[model samples]
Target: MGAEYGQEGLVSTSCDIYSFGIMMMEVFTSKKPTDEMFTSDLSLSHWVSKALVNGVTQAMDSRLIRKDEENFFAEVNCVSSIFELALNCTAESPENRINIKDALAFLQKIRLEFLVKLSEN
Candidate 1:
């Protein structure tokens, strides 16, 4: 019942890599990745990439904004790097992408850096 891609057909590992990337993007942006929002080739990934290039504030959901936000800009920058990683994992070509294990390791590094900064503050 599954569609074939080529000589190898379908591989579960690649699917999981793509899924991990999507999940990370969702957690960072808090947006659902349904195809409906991605009509006309405009996907959640696309929006996030555009937003990152423009400004992190523009990418963030308005609901998450606070009246007297102090660390908002810093947080946005942090999330932007994470977004970039997700984008790379979700690249069009599987050969151009990193696997789930690598993605997790990268995320953990980011988290550790974020924690160090928090402790310093």
Candidate 2:
């Protein structure tokens, strides 16, 4: 369930989107929502958002960076876009959250851009 579902008791597709966003964050950052570091003010989402302000390298999984040193720029760009998408999906307002169709489209675009950059390197 999402913030809207928990707060308003409303069940909708947005709830699933929120879950997806959280899952994305977890996969990218290797941090679970229930991690000891997360608190009321500092959530997994907030942690990622703040880390991104410095650099995606600070927020992303270390294994990814270590494995793709040659394509670090493209990898960072793709991960940053992914985190942005996750933030949008996890918006507090259900109406403000992105739909599945849009999310898929955005992800596809990110993938294509990443591939292009990878090929250029």
RMSD of each: 3.6, 1.4
- For 1-121, candidate 1 gives per-residue lDDT tens digits of 1012354577666666667777877776678777467776788778888988898667666666553666655566578778888887777667778877788788888788777766666
lDDT tens readout by residue for model 2, 32-112:
999998898899988888877987778788977775478877888899999999998988788999999999999999999
Worst 10 residues of 2 by lDDT: 64-73
Q: How many backbone clashes does candidate 2 have?
A: 0
Best by lDDT: 2
Candidate 2, residue 107: the lDDT equals: 97
lDDT of each: 0.71, 0.90
Candidate 2 clashing pairs? Answer: none
Cα TM-score per model? 0.76, 0.93
Candidate 1 regions off by >4 Å?
1-9, 64-67
Please provide the root mean square deviation of candidate 2 (C-alpha atoms, Å).
Answer: 1.4
